[model samples]
Target: MFGFGIYDALIIAGFLGLQFFLSARNSAYWGAIIPVLFISWLTWLLVSGEIKSILAYLLILSIGFIVLLLEWSEGRKALRNRREKELAKMRSYDMN
Candidate 1:
């Protein structure tokens, strides 16, 4: 078992708390912060000897990669939607 230091635990807790609060506010951008928080904390653990095994490193990397992928996918979708709306407006203007 790995024991988390007070500061480490506090940072994690803060991230989780902010995530929850932002989620309740219906802000999707806040969800992207999760990956940043996770990566930083995981890296800290890796360097601090809290996460020692190769398997653990691989597992954390895989999970972080997935989360990052999801975040980017969502962002791309939103960007595409905004572009479509802009194109639609431009087309409408050309017809008039």
Candidate 2:
């Protein structure tokens, strides 16, 4: 009643919590499970009449997946840069 729906608040909190956990892990690899995951949760929630729960879960899952992908790309970029530096050093040594 704080000028917002309870479900909306709950969803926001849930998303924040999930984001924190997933971001801390720095991987959205779990997003790979999301399609089947959301569907399964949706089915169960529907049966239980917990519609809001599924919506919150879906939003969090989607956001978390995207963040994970971003983290992975950054990691890959960092790794590539490191390897390139190593290779350049090796080539320089060969020239010497």
The candidate scoring highest on TM-score is 1
Q: What do the candidate models score in CA lDDT, each in turn? A: 0.68, 0.57
lDDT of 1 by residue, 1-96 (tens): 456799978975675555554433435666567677677777888889888886887797787658565555655566567778999999999999
Local accuracy of candidate 2 as per-residue lDDT tens digits, 1-96? 024788978975665444444433434454334335545655676667655565665675577556545554554555567678999999999999
Pairs clashing in candidate 2? 28-68
- Where is model 1 poorest over a 10-residue stretch in terms of lDDT? 18-27
Question: What is the lDDT, from 0 to 100, of the residue 56 in candidate 2?
Answer: 69
In model 2, the number of clashes is: 1
lDDT of 1 at 25: 40
